[model samples]
Target: MLARVAAAARVRPPERTGALLSATLVLSVGKGAFLATVMVYLLQIVGLTPLLATAGLTLWGAASAAVAVPTGLLVDRGRGRAVGSVAAVCAALLVPLSARVHTPWALLLVLCVAGGFDSAGNVVRRAMLAGAGGDSVKALAWARTVTNIGFALGALCSVRLLASRSPSAYETAYLLIGGGYLVMAACFATTSLGAGRRGSPSVRAPGVVGARSLRTGGALAAATGILTVHTTLLSTVLPLWVTRHASVPVSVLGWLVMLNSLIAVGGQLAVSRRAATREGALRCFRNSAVWTAGCCLLLGLVRFAPTGWQVVLLVAATIALTGGELLEAAGEWGLSAVLAAADEHGFYQSACVLGETTQGAAGPLLVAGLVTAAPVAGWIVLVAVLGAGRYIAGFTTPPPHKAIAIDS
Candidate 1:
């Protein structure tokens, strides 16, 4: 019986790809712990005032934003593995060093460095998967599952540690996360996924992506940026819209978030199965846009519905949003892998990250300016824009056959 169960689990991605996914899981676990404990550590252990801590966080964000594109460029130069390893090592070191640092300046400096490494590390992982041939969407779907589980586990573990309410326990948690990073670094160092020599030739000297290809990539990036509004809708827009406008109880928001997370953790694999090929991926992308627009429409409908019906509409909207989120994620992974130039996954993914960055910077303002002020009009405009994306997505062509092969 045990052997049968083990065999059942063996029907998974190739062994070489496990390194990246495992690393992501371990790193995500550490990040989960860090998220729960960092503020307390900064205030209680590092002796930084709340304002200084906020400033340190702000500096870290700035540093991450500044380095996002450059790091992608670095990965495109065939240094994905090296860069990921360095970032992992730095992340591992940052935790222990953070416990030692007390001054705001020192904390800011440490956070800034960590932030850059963090962004670079994400780029490396995504680029590696984009170049890793053979069912990139499915691999990413598995990755998302592992990441969610790891984060949930880490958060639960952190809760136990924090229950002690002792400074030493916090230190121990940081050290534990450092150990996870060490494991992640080792995975990158030993794995063959995009770990070419440190001094390979430039991937972008010339003729890497033609004008047409670059333009297509750019448009995809813009669409991705627009899709980031889904995140904003979940994190910012929904909370405000529901509480202030939707006439629903505040607790429903928490339940909705839980539901979304659950769906992401459980449903991604099933959704990714249909996205194995480029045509299927494009189909999913178009459908995701339709679902996203439907979510917006549902949210808009909440205001017009009766009191009891409002809850139903709101729930429906959440479901639609989650579906769109999962479908979009799978489709994007497939698109990134399918549309990239040969050996240029890093550059292509980096270009896509530009959209994420744009969303991060602009989404909040747009939500405040549009959704908050005129919910119906705002949603209609979003629907129109995303509807247009459905048409644009149909134009994406798959890369050549050889380009889809796994990186050696």
Candidate 2:
């Protein structure tokens, strides 16, 4: 039964292209934890103030937000190897420079370069997976699972490094993350997914429709809005809240994040079976909205956390919010991919990131501003957004029946 269940869990890959794909997830998500905890590290350990940390975050999010699409463009234009290698080297430098520099301007500069390069690399890797299209959805799910695994492991590792080391722990973490990213570049450059490395997505065409056929004007907007709020809370907002509220002793955070990643990985795999169906897509999105909203309200109630047990409960609630991320991301990608035109694969994938990054950029600033004033109120706003997302998800029609594949 265990073997049967395990067999059912993994779909056969189109190609046995192993480490290159795995390394992409490892590099991107491993560094991504810094999106949340690094703020705390910068402020508390590096001696930057709250406002400066916030400013640095805001700058990073703003500087080259559409990098995903351009990264996609680079691949489409056949510059994949060049962009991927350059971005990897940049990733190696982005955070380490932060440790030495305390000036807001210098940090923001490195942060911008880092953000664009990181964003570019994310698309390159996804394009790599998309290049494996006959295995498309399942492949992406595995990619998601691998990325989440990296997320869990990276968060845990960062915490351990911070705990045992002295004040230099933040520097150590950044350097290691940079090295991992540089290694990622090496893996990509040398492996089967390299630009020179050749294979095609079953056909060099989207099986559903061509890019021009995708419902652009209204459908994209509706879908984008629904997905934006879901990811903002999951990736940025909740992480920030935990860092601020439950984070005096940071050792426990890695496990909590790991647990969060584990739930997401499972959710991504479990839902993969029926998740692409139109009904299934709508169902998951709405469910995540309600789940996240309920979790948000729970965030406001932390004042009522009476003891250590309650603190644990609070952490659990936050984990639920993070779990919702898995549901939203899997479904969102499914919908976007199924409805996208053949030529639009690049845009189709970039749409999700662009949507999420737009919200993520705003989410932190919203969080920073609100928390800087009234932390609880900031949380209340997230609940409101979640509720609205759920409502939108429920009311929206499935994609049009014209040349699309909403799965079985």
Candidate 3:
């Protein structure tokens, strides 16, 4: 599958292939390290109560989102290098600061800054990749695959430390994350991205990437909005819901989440292969939605579980939702690549991320409000809403306009 994708999206390496590889490595390792361990570290070691932790996560979401607007504009304006480089520095500095902090308020502030720079750097990378022609999917996949692997690897390491009955080890995770950022920063600074100007800024690829003629901005905005709602329901409300009504302990929750992450890491490459067909991709996405929504519905039926099967039911539901996550990820990256024009690629991709961040920002707050409003199955209600949103977004796509390729 990997070889096929590489072949299908043949990589005619951009000038400075070596540099881009370094950039990919640095970005993946740097961001992946802390990004993976953050949630677990906060919940397990930082001793943040769920409420404060959600707030900190919200801070990260909002800041990351706020940065996307300017970062997108900057990338479109072709000022990516500096913005990208600065992002690395901010990420590096913030990781260590985050390591030392105990106060929820302080972590909130640090996450905001960290999220902003991290997102900005990512947007710049998207723009740079869009500018590289002839192998957009492969390039994007390579980058994503690496980051996914890094996150899994980094998170495993952090988990071991946190599991060792030594709270101080949590700090070690943060420092390691900082080191990743530092390495990424250095990689970006020294690498030569221009391979004799072959894929230079002056040259434009033939696709719907840069040109705004058939603008799918409206389609993208609507689709992204719906998808964002789904994120909130799953990430914020679902966990809280399990805490409230499910037959589970805090420790059980950790393992439950682990199940999802394990599936994601193990399945991403397998799922990436399904992108070869648009309808097939959508079918997978739809199936995930159906299963996720169905699972959400099934939570209400847990009282009917067989003897000692309550945990089994919850685990099953979680796996279904994660399956949806897998499909959504595949569709998102593939469609973003297909929809973007060379010049405008960064903006569109950032738009997708922005949509996610915005929804993420709202998720915790919304979940908080709902719990306050109605303690009975509030999370379940929210999950249903998200499932609805996902279903709506999937079906409401505007009719395709003559099968336009991203880079014509």
Highest TM-score against the true fold, candidate: 1
Model 2 residue 183 CA deviation in Å: 2.6
Runs with alpha carbons beyond 4 Å of true place in candidate 1 = 1-11, 36-62, 95-109, 158-171, 195-210, 304-307, 388-408
Q: Model 1, residue 287: displacement in angstroms?
A: 2.5
lDDT of 2 by residue, 12-34 (tens): 54474567656756675557656
Cα error, candidate 1, residue 212 (Å) = 3.9
> Which lDDT values do the candidates have, in the order given?
0.74, 0.62, 0.63
Per-model TM-score, in order, reads 0.80, 0.75, 0.73
How well is each residue in 1-408 modelled by candidate 1, as lDDT tens digits? 999668646758644688788888888998888866777777766778988876666566566656766666677666777888898889888876776667778878988787777767777777777666666667767877888788777777788766676777777778888888888788877877762234535444522455555666776677777765777788678888888786678899878988888988868887887777778877787788878888899988888888799988888898999999888877777777777655567766766666665576567667657877777788888888887777666655534453344221
How far is 133's C-alpha from truth in model 2 (Å)? 1.7
Clashes of 3: 17
lDDT of 3 by residue, 257-316 (tens): 678777776677567567545565455545555655655565555545653576877777
After superposition, the stretches of candidate 2 with alpha carbons farther than 4 Å from their true spots are 1-14, 28-37, 44-46, 164-173, 190-259, 277-279, 297-323, 367-384, 387-408
Ranking by TM-score: 1, 2, 3
